[model samples]
Target chain A: DVKVTQSSRYLVKRTGEKVFLECVQDMDHENMFWYRQDPGLGLRLIYFSYDVKMKEKGDIPEGYSVSREKKERFSLILESASTNQTSMYLCASSLTGEGHNEQFFGPGTRLTVL
Target chain B: LAKTTQPISMDSYEGQEVNITCSHNNIATNDYITWYQQFPSQGPRFIIQGYKTKVTNEVASLFIPADRKSSTLSLPRVSLSDTAVYYCLVGAWEDTPLVFGKGTRLSVIA
Candidate 1:
């Protein structure tokens, strides 16, 4: 079975602080993604990495950045956290684009900004 | 990303078959329809995926028409634990993100 693990399952940060969320997938999938889920708004993509050092902005990329220095690890960073940025962060990975491949997701990290 | 639309919520009793329909009018040629189940405070779990016709797994079945314009997720004899939000996505590109709809919140009653 494919397993995706996140470093922190829950985190709390003060306003204007820097936050880093780490994710690692055991399957060595080529694609990784970060998304923030909110009630009534659904899940909005923040950033995605197709390969090492290659990143792409998703629908909502403001105030969020991602790093993919290695294949198994993907990190989401908030340079300066704000209260409005608090959300449930999900990390997912999949094989290269082809046909219909289901994304394997991590447990998720609930971030609270005060 | 192809657009998808589904009901906001649904209510069903235990042991009943629950079918949720998702409409994707502009699904592309290479696009495939996929369904995910999400529980509160957890990430979405992959349920099923199909390009056309029908695909079935231990958990659920996916039915897609010839036109590839829509898809339906059928849950067989659902149990109380099956209650959760179901999201439908039309995406074949892995790097490309799947657009999630409001999703249908299914409540199972005894």
Candidate 2:
């Protein structure tokens, strides 16, 4: 079984603060992703990393950035958190190539920017 | 990723079989259909995946017709725990992020 763990389950921060959400996967997957889920909007991708130090922007990557310094860890960074940035953040990891398959998601972190 | 369409919501009773269908008119030949289940306050979990015909797993079964334009997920003998949102995805076998549209919110009542 694959396991994905997040650094925080719930977080609260003031406006203009820098926020970091971390994710770690037990399996040695090559692909990692970050997403935000909002009511009525479903889940929207924020960023994804195919390999170490390799990142790509998703559809809604305007307000967020990502880091993949190591194989098992991926981090999401908010340069300046705003109230509109409050959302449930999700992390997922998957294998590449012929082993390419569905992602395994971690329990999301609900962040609130006050 | 091809666009998918499913119901907004569905209602079912306990011990009854639930079938949620998804339509993907522009699904490519190499694309496969996958389903994920998500409860409130949690990330989605993989349920099943299939390309053509029937594919069964321990938790659920996936049914795809010959045309490959649509697919159906079947859950046998549902319980209250089965109440969750089900998302249908269509994509090639590659390392791409799952594109989740408005999923079908299924409520399994007692």
lDDT (0 to 1) per candidate: 0.90, 0.93
Model 2 residue B107 lDDT? 99
Candidate 1, residues B1-110: lDDT per residue as tens digits?
Answer: 78899999999999999999999999989788889999887889888888899999999999999999999999999999999999999876652667776789999999
Residue A22 error, candidate 1, Å = 0.5
Q: Can you give the TM-score per candidate against the true fold?
A: 0.95, 0.98
- DockQ, candidate no. 2: 0.75
- Interface RMSD list for the candidates: 2.3, 1.5
Candidate 1 differs from the real structure by a C-alpha RMSD in angstroms, to one decimal, of 1.4
Q: After superposition, how far is residue A40 of candidate 2 from its true place, in Å?
A: 1.1
Model 2 chain A: weakest 10-residue lDDT segment is: A94-103
The top-ranked prediction according to DockQ is 2
Candidate 2 chain B weakest lDDT stretch, 10 residues: B93-102
